[model samples]
Target: MRKITKGIAPVSFMEWVRQKPRNVDDNQWFQELYKQKRWDIVSDLSHHNAREQFYLCAYCCSEISGEGQETVNEHVEARALASHRSLDFTNIVASCKTKGQCDAHHKSQALPLTPLMDECETEFHFKISGRVEGKSARAIESIRVLNLGDNERNNKSLIEKRKQLSHNLMMANGLDPDEGLEDDELLLAVIDDLLTPTEGRLSPFAPVVANILRSWISG
Candidate 1:
């Protein structure tokens, strides 16, 4: 639900796309290119090739810490046919969302929601219990298709992090850390208080997640 800014494509990447033949629009062809080198086009497209690829989990938006970092996967945004048929930036999303399963579910309905598609905020909400349920059927389906709901450990870890951040914020504001609040309440309070529109920030997903938390708490 939040916008991710860290691994955003650079202007140079657009230039590279421009330099590549506009006629090179074939799904199979791009698939072969991806097979040859996973991020050949991506490297040319973005300056955030280093840390951005490794630290962020594509699905749950959890920071892949400790051993998770080693096991973390960075999936190229293109499907063979999907890429070849279209060269638009929206089609290419660097995601940690794929959870090692492929099925009819993996294929997007139409313009599958990824971090690059910012407006997805309207689709889902986070619960105070740290559960991410969809605001609609499409949102629920998207969460399932991407295996977002299956990663219980990742979600719990993020919720705990939100808790700690909330506690710290309350303490800084001269409020008791144990102010008769449940875990979700404290977390939502922190998000509502601290997160605001910041310029040139990374991780748009953070706010979306926070908003979901807020919705859950308020509800």
Candidate 2:
């Protein structure tokens, strides 16, 4: 996962929250916000977070598309745990639809690593075979909790997709795995492109792709 720099909360949402009755209970206020069907606020938050995350899921790095349930405004600290921050802008992220896997299905389970934190990118290791393993206990917990590598629910799992993407990237760059060309400048350029982060778009499972590419060339 990549780090997302939380942007300012939408002014409209801020105003709405500020206008709420001061004595309202936090949980009640949260319920009210949902009951109001203030999807405009949710849309605003999703768009902003989608951009910040380069249009990828904050948890599994899947490409987020469409306005349907495939993409959702996921609360970083679940509303159940932090009802007080329900409307807090920084507490939300854009994640792929949770159809048994992904972020939305995980609920309030504690994460060992979060994209909000800088070091999260390095907390897991990706294998060329499409397997993902945590670098620490916390990272392991995060993987299981998020179902980052789960393949049971769907025919294609997160790791499987990542492996395909990596292979495609290699093929697109004309890098041959069967040959030993570690010092080739063209190969290095290909690896660099995979490693570099873009401003408004990130390749799915970019970190995993980059790491695998680096190992391929170095080996």
Candidate 3:
């Protein structure tokens, strides 16, 4: 997981969206507000929400089902509105989890880690067992909240990536993949690569992503 500082919505725009009263139940008010702030609501929401969803499951970071695969919009249920600040854009995010789960589980102590505010990429890394482990209590809480292991559809992707990385590393050194590096060692090497980018550091998958590639090669 990487922190995506690129293309973040402007603070002013976020402030504007945050002012809207999203928690209200008046359909007429909501309809009117939606019409009034259509551009602010739609464009920024589309971009930022999609960006958020792309990192983790829109609702739960434990999964990779981003926008288009599920209801990526950060949906707030009537019951959950009580806890929301306002209908502002800051309160919402893209989510794949059903409204029920997003509302019930997200509000609880066991919410999945979100890349938006949680920054699990800074704190967590993949283990040899294919589980995502992190340093913060919030990171661990998020793992439990989203049930990263329970979601086979999403976790399988990470597992496959790790396997490929291990294989690539072994092949690079003309050794069997079964003789892979330790998980922590691989993570440290990845960090080293991240800190040192040799080329094309400004591309979409830049310095940090390059390090991930390096780790896979050195598996």
Candidate 4:
């Protein structure tokens, strides 16, 4: 997953938070966001979060529309565990509401590593086979928590999907899956292009593809 550079909280959302009663708990206030139909504040929060992350799920790096059926305003530190952070803007992110992966798989479990950390991008290794492995202990746990398809047993579709996309990218660039390319400059350029988001959005699975490509030159 890519690091999410969180920016300022929405003005309206902060204003609403300030008005909350002293006795009210964060989770209660958070739910009231829906019960009260505070669409304006909720919309602002989702839009800002999604835009900053380039519309990718914070966990699996999948495409997301920010909020609605395709996305949920996910609390990075679950409200059940960290009740105090229930309304903390920095603790929240936009995650795909997929049934058995990413946010859905996460539930209230703690994430030892999260996109909020810069090391997150480097701690995981992505293979052309469409599988990922954690380079560190925390990364490993995070992978399992997010169900990022470390193997076919955990998530076959995601593995196959990543494999197909990354292989296609390699072929398009005239690189072999095993030997890669003899030209290091060209390889670096391709990696840079993949890492750079266009129109505030990266190509689907581009980060995973780029990660696999980088391994070629490093080896």
For model 2, state the Cα shift of residue 119 in Å. Answer: 1.7
Q: Which stretches of candidate 3 lie over 4 Å from their true place?
A: 4-44, 51-71, 75-82, 96-113, 117-119, 150-219
lDDT of 3 by residue, 1-219 (tens): 444333565464566545646565433333444567655544555556555444444433333333344434443333244344334454455555443344334553434455445364555554444445556886666655554432345455545544455445435434443454456565565545443424423222222233333445543
In angstroms, the error of model 4 at 140 is 1.0
Q: For residues 50-143, could you state the per-residue lDDT of candidate 4 as single tens digits?
A: 8888888888777887667687888989899999999999999998887788888998999999999999889999987788999999999999
State the C-alpha lDDT per candidate: 0.47, 0.71, 0.45, 0.85
TM-score of model number 4: 0.92
Residue pairs in candidate 2 whose N, alpha carbon or C atoms collide under 3 angstroms: none
Residue 27 accuracy (lDDT) in model 1 = 54
**Rank by lDDT, descending?**
4, 2, 1, 3
Best by lDDT: 4
Which is better, 2 or 4, measured by lDDT? 4
- Which regions in candidate 1 have their CA more than 4 angstroms from the true location? 4-12, 19-24, 32-41, 44-59, 64-85, 101-119, 150-205, 216-219
Number of the top-ranking candidate, with TM-score as the measure: 4
Per-residue alpha-carbon lDDT of model 2 for 74-138, expressed as tens digits? 77777778788776778878899957666655788766578888777777776766777788898
Name the 10 consecutive residues with the lowest summed lDDT in model 4. 210-219
